[model samples]
Target: MKSIRIDRNRRLRDDPGTGHNRWHPDIEPLIEVAPGEEVLLETRDAADGQVKPHMTFADLAKNDKKVGHPLTGPVFVKGAEPGDILEVEFVDMTPQPYGWTVIRPGVGFLREVFDAEFLAHWHVDGKFARSPQIPGVRIPEGIFMGTAGVAPSHEQMRSWNARETELVSRGGLALLPDPQDAIPASQPIASEGLRTMPPRENGGNADIKQLTRGSKLQLPVSVSGALFSTGDAHYAQGDSECCITAIEMGATAVVRFNLLKGEAVRRKTRFPRFSHPGYFAAPEWAAPHNFVATTGFPIREDGTQECEDLTLAARNAVLEMIALLGERGFSREQAYVICSLAVDLRISNVVDLPNVCVSALLPEAIFER
Candidate 1:
């Protein structure tokens, strides 16, 4: 029944942080609370509050991109430990009055297609996010935290970073910079923050738009006290998140924490799960501009993609979307815009290779009714 104020005492690794994009057990808890309590959580934008209302891509490019997605906790829940389920119910999430999206060179699903730098700004009111920058576009309010997680144990950090290092060494990752080159000699490798780019077991940037208010996110505790923190607020986002950026904004949420134990303490390869209880109406899910899309992988019972790639998965989904648009007699540009604004792309499963399906829930509603 206590409140944790979101302030300076919560800062950790990254620029304003002690180091890089990592969360470690050593970072000291900013506040402590027992399970089954509510706290009003405040957060900065994914760019760590760097891009202002009047700022342009040039302004953002000058500022350090490393320090953003500034998370706001390490909130120690009394009696929480590893193998426990940390359930966070987002009672509410409210975005700020402004937001922006950036498409930088060498980033996004279609990076090769559009290699230049682009920025778009939006005016976010209490209800909708509209852009004068992109006339005739209005996005509905479905604000959610793009990143949230508890700290991993030291062993987890080494294993995670080591795997990434292995990938870089094997040239499996082309865009990722070498970690060794990025981290200084003085900082402890285990102490640095985990990269906030990809989704991991500890849940950094899991950008599922369905995880809005009324959604409960269950994460496995790798470290004691379940040092939970969150940032990367998005006012709205398509499923593919193809552009590498969403409508980023600073926001606040009232989170109610609960501990799930017994058989509920399961970790899906370290990835967390988001669920909405009860049969609540989801008009948006089937709205005209939207339709439940299925991405076909057609993998054999015993086959593999042979590559660690979501880009390829996105390609399949986009191709499916293009086909869907063709059915409606829409052009490529029309389909692309609809995908940007309405399509919610989600990986159905990557485990079942050959047919690792990716679903692009098409918002048929994107087209005129």
Candidate 2:
């Protein structure tokens, strides 16, 4: 039951051997902890070491894009081998006093239309966050990771690359080796810099807010020792995460790791699953406030919704939200933050043919009169 803590002083590339941001099988381990030991991890925000409280959009534009989801740790667990279940239990999370939400050009679900970059800053206080600039908007704090998981294996890498490449050849979205326009060859995981931008089977970037304090995420080990790393902490976020960025904040996650040894308990988990000590059924973070819902249909009767894309559908929902908030005199940036923190997306009908509608729900309580 050794308790190990890693902060800004220690990271993957911050050390002599381990890599940074992107995931790979080869990054050296920083600590070797026994099974069922607790680990305290400190992480920088998604802006990698830049984008502080005083930074503007110009400062954000200057951030290095080399590291996709800048995080902490690759602690190698003792006696843990491949195919074992690495139970990452959430003991608690300590977030920084400030947080941010961004809308970058050509990113997120509505890239084409919302092309201009925008930024909104918040005063985070563990329980709630609100921006003085935005006015009358209160975001209830719900801390959970935007990215967390074990590094990928060689076989998993192949599978990932093959699938993404196949999709790209057919004009699908590209996401494998992060879209860094110029990645250095000497950078660790450079040649094989598997982006942590999208979620994968290895559990990278699993942005489910249901992974709050009372839950444990069971990730199947791919490589030896279950080289685990985590970052991209968000104070709160909606389901669709249409804006790309959530309430991005730097937080410390105190996690207890356990190795489910032998062939018995390991058989219970195939994909990543959760174990909650709380109630029977927990929705992704409690939203007790009544919400105004809007339905978005991603089709226009003659197949003009562009390949029936889910991205288009999600964006349509967000657009409807923007319109509603605009009618109430909220700026688009304010509306975007409202969407990230206060809105939730639900699929109304995906099998209805020629039209899939995603409903975006805006919690009425966030608006202060």
Candidate 3:
């Protein structure tokens, strides 16, 4: 299999030729591969190696957020073109021995309530992720790439920028284009390149944990050669990465690409789609043989209700789960981290108008008896 390797000690910016941190059609491809060829990519952690295992949460403020997702490649699939479908089959994933999860202030699902920074350093094996910072819990390994995508066409980039600019004007949250710490550090590409945080039609940072080994992700191509790139490996993560992170780590991903000519155009697919062959996680953890579930409605603590707000419902469910964990002797910070690493958030009801119900399920099997 062909591969692109990088030094774990160095950042992707230090060797930009190996990878890039932004999404633009003109970034150029590092290597070319035909359909059905398996390629191995060595990826940096989501923070681009900025948050090391040795560092505590106190050091998080020094890291550059702009250099967040350092993706491995824009591998030129030989015949891929716009409107084609790039099917990436994940064959295997190997995580580094150590991993981390962090809760930073001013971010995440409960950012308003969780303003304090917390961090957990984990010892990851093939089967589980165990952290000393949050004791008594083990997160089952459901290794997957948190970010993966094809570069957007120039038209898509311009259109996306215009729309996001409008959103920012309307007091919405959007990470606009900034060149300060861009990897390629080129001229107009650096200044105009789209940020990798939002998953677009080209599928950037869609942090779905179910894209594990044996899963296939189909990305709608928008540029010549597909310019496919990936990074932000996760050892394990819950359905809702409520804390803004999972067991984040550097990992080597083995994937095989197959081009479906004009498939995206034929189906008018504009977003990424994925399918897993068997269980995405070990069966026991996937279905949770023994689970503790906390249900929440759109009702807030002040007795105010959100009309069919699924986001608020999810937030309430997670908060309730955290409180339950606190009752079991865990600190609020530790409970939040636990929720991020292992709590699965499920929508129990949405058809009930004016009130949505969400459930946060914590697998009891994760805790040692």
Candidate 4:
């Protein structure tokens, strides 16, 4: 049982499938680790070395591939058999001395509205990143990986597709059968390409905020050794990640892996959900709001009703704002898109509301701060 320490300066390559970049921990010349052991990797930011402190927008224009989101590895887990679950526990994410986030004209969730290159840089002069928006809002600097996951059970998937394209659901590890299995296990399971941001069973681009430090993620093991890789580090991101990118940055991660065999796991394609037993905290326009969050699980098989109802409830909550915006002349489509992109749906006050007053946070940076 040996340990591997992968450094941040290791050479990385672009992942053609995801249009993101990555590195394999096991193949690194400087680090070596055996199965059932652990590895520590010092990672780089999302710009993949393209953006460094003191580098200007002109420098960013010089690099063909902006290399900020560099993934650490396709670390091979020795003896990890199919039908097993690889448990990855995130230990710590200490931010580099600095980080950056940009809003490009043609990119981001609101590209149509803000069609201009907007770059924001933050350096940890001491303890926080100064916020340009609110002179009083200073954020404690923290680093967390934005993208992390294992190889697909079958062939590599295409970028821009959802993580669920060829693999299982989001968050949970995949369970890939060996090629020797009667079902021809190595074949790609689905035809969908890869997802742009959301996480899938193959665990790519999962932007779940709870995947932070002190959380355990279980991935299904499909092939021998479970070729696992992780990348897409973020400094801080709000829920729904309305911005195309978080405070994208690199990170060093200490990961511990364990195997679970034949456990009865649930297979659902919905986004990950969490529960707060007592009262939970949420932001309010005028006051601090507390609510008991609860969700209504739709009985319909297709989930159309559930999605529709959830969308309507979201609209209703902002009816006054919508009317005001419309009165000021914003179109219905624009208002709807605003809600869709900026709003986050959560179970709220399940015990009190008739249909479970699902809480939707609308672009509040309160959580990130």
Q: Rank order by TM-score, top first?
A: 3, 2, 1, 4
**Residue by residue across 1-369, what tens digits does model 2's lDDT show?**
443344554433454233257778877777778877787777667766566778888886666666667757787888777878888888888888888888888887767767766788889754678887688887777788778888788878878888888998999886667536312235545667677777787787878877888688888887888888888888888877777888888888888888876532448555687767772454424554478888777764366755455556777788889989999998887787678776889888878765777889887766667
How do the residues 173-272 of candidate 1 rate in per-residue lDDT, one tens digit apiece?
5223233323222355323546667777877788887788888998888788888888788887787677678888878877888987632354333568
Q: Once model 4 is optimally superposed onto the true structure by TM-score, how far is the C-alpha of residue 341 displaced, in angstroms?
A: 14
For every model shown, what is its TM-score relative to the native structure?
0.79, 0.86, 0.97, 0.61
After superposition on all C-alphas, the RMSD of every candidate to the true structure, in Å, is 5.5, 3.5, 1.2, 9.7
What is the alpha-carbon lDDT of model 2 when measured against the actual structure?
A: 0.74
Between candidates 1 and 2, the one scoring higher on TM-score is: 2
- Give the per-residue lDDT of model 4 (tens digit) for 36-97: 56777666665555666676556677764423344555566766766666777676666666
In model 3, the runs with Cα more than 4 Å from the true position are none
lDDT score for candidate 4 against the true structure? 0.48
The candidate maximizing TM-score is 3
List, residue by residue over 44-156, the lDDT tens digit for candidate 3: 99988887778987788788869978999989999998889999999999998888988878989999999877889999756888988978888888889999999998999
Model 1 error, position 119 (Å): 0.8
Name the lDDT value of residue 186 in candidate 1: 39
CA shift of 196, model 1, Å: 1.5
